[model samples]
Target: MSDFLVVGGGVIGMMTTLQLADAGHSVTLLERGRCGREASWAGGGIVSPLYPWRYTAPISRLSGWSEGYYPELALRLYEETGVDPEYRQKGLLYLRVEDEARAMAWAREVGKPLERVSADFLYAKEPEVAPGCQEALWMPTLGSIRNPRLTRALHARLSAMQGVTLREECEVRGFRQAGGRVTAVETSQGPVAADQVLVCGGAWAAALLEEVGITLPVRPVKGQMILFKAPPGLVNRVVLMDGRYVIPRADGRVLAGSTLEDAGFDKTVSGEARESLWASATRIVPALADCLVEHHWAGLRPGSPDGVPFIGAVPGLENLHVNAGHYRNGLVLAPAATRLMVDELLGRAPILDPAPYALEGRLAGGL
Candidate 1:
């Protein structure tokens, strides 16, 4: 069995570690703070390819495959760790106000049971939705998982694994690379050696890689989201309108998000952003206007120049790999990215092609 060290404890890192451990490899996960408390927890939990029709074929395939995996994975994790991931298949509704022809054509090509619903029909289905809103595309294939529960479930399951060790509150200072291979990692506690190292730090990857003379063109894209305490049946499906979304949680909380900002490590929840999100939520669903604000949070998505995740081995280092830069879709893309990373490490064919998201492609594109 191989002894592998995975840096970062977000969803990507946790999923990667679980995959490696399942493959009979010894995996150690090091987290700088509370595991999964970063972007993975902060995401809106919209489990789609994000503009599914616009994503490259390979990226779309990865997301589609991962979406199929969530149901079974959720069950297995819940059974193993006794922690429910809160996987929900409530579906996604995308409001289309412009480019109706293009939207219909693209929907036809994807063949995901897309249907144009009238405003009255939408209101009939989701009574809480605002009547002023126009038509929307009903995408029934979409689903979501409670991100925080998934992270906690993964962490618990990995902790129970015989070959997996999770070192929480351990901040990685730098890497020790020699002969083009990362030999060990320097952390706050001390040095830990492993046969292979995987850098899965989310928004903080670029900074971490810079310490080792490698520059990952990953930047922090801040997203601000707000939550409202609504009834469980307040909104039956995920609704997207005016470039904002309202996702209904299983626990009677409605998630309204988000503002994309190019802020670096600044996770402050701004009042203006919150107000804008609240306004958008109210516009989409008038009932949210009367709902009480439960919480608000901001997270930095690790955005790559091309807006695709960085998977597979890092260049100039054979045993060192990268699985970061997932941006806004980290939670949605975690399973597939982890599966591909494990497959590559084991010299097996990946679940999906890694070319589009390879580190070399990022360099060639001048990102």
Candidate 2:
């Protein structure tokens, strides 16, 4: 029996598994499909939330903690695996805001380095921006990473670590319980006994827990993205207009996305969404209108009812914990979330207050 069994092979599960294994625990991670090929692979890789001011306090806490930890983690990953996740401090520019006052106030409250720039200043900074965007907010401390690359690096690093086993193509069918504790997990291959179990199944978490009479409020939120191949230095930094964004990678590839749709588990990319995203991209950065659209794809984000992820022990179930429901911020929040989960599992002092993210705590509150 392994000391820990992590269900789901996304960024959250992989990070949690790595942390546990590094802490001298026997860990096995099970994934229905190939690891990290889900939402973690399809995200824009923005290290900060799209609209930081709009999210609740708990969300901010996780994002803040992660923003500080990702650079060091990326460096370590590169040193160990020789795989660069392309963690970049490119910053974020919000092109339009309905409540600029509120945004500025929130930035000040959070001690974020935010500056209001006029249209002329924005154009001087990023000449490719569309002409009509007259004002913007510049967040200098925000960063991004190549999500797919980061996931690959994590998988490789975890595989090389001692006492870590990754089981891809191993779909967890159900759980075996004894006296309200999940003692073992039944997989398609076979039953694996575990001292503890963590369900980080992303969008499928709710359905997985339902078999045990637990209803977690998480669902699949489909988001589609389009990729554009442009010359290097085309879009200087991440640009945001409303909720949609355009992220420029170091290799001259720009990612423009996405549409939040309640489309269940269907990840089909629609023509409507493609055109909409293309329009948004061109509208934000006029130069993108000329760039060749390489391809488009979609992923399912684990949408939560309260927008705050559940990251603690399961009520009434011993040796069973949860670390899912991160919605759209999984990549940005992965590092800190993993630390918090491992801290709880090891009975150590938590790095942050656990009340806001408690499984059964009140849904409304902030840090």
Clashing pairs for predicted structure model 1, backbone only? none
Q: Each candidate: what lDDT? A: 0.86, 0.90
lDDT of 2 by residue, 119-201 (tens): 88888778988788778899988899999999999999998998988899998888888898987889998998889999999
Q: What RMSD does each model have against the real structure?
A: 1.6, 2.2
The TM-score obtained by model 1 is 0.96
Model 2: number of backbone collisions: 0
Model 2 residue pairs with clashes: none
lDDT of 2: 0.90
What digit string (tens of lDDT, one per residue) describes model 1 on residues 12-103? 99999998888898988999998999999998888885467766666666787788899999999999999999899978887754655666
TM-score of each: 0.96, 0.97
Show where candidate 1 strays beyond 4 Å. Answer: 364-367
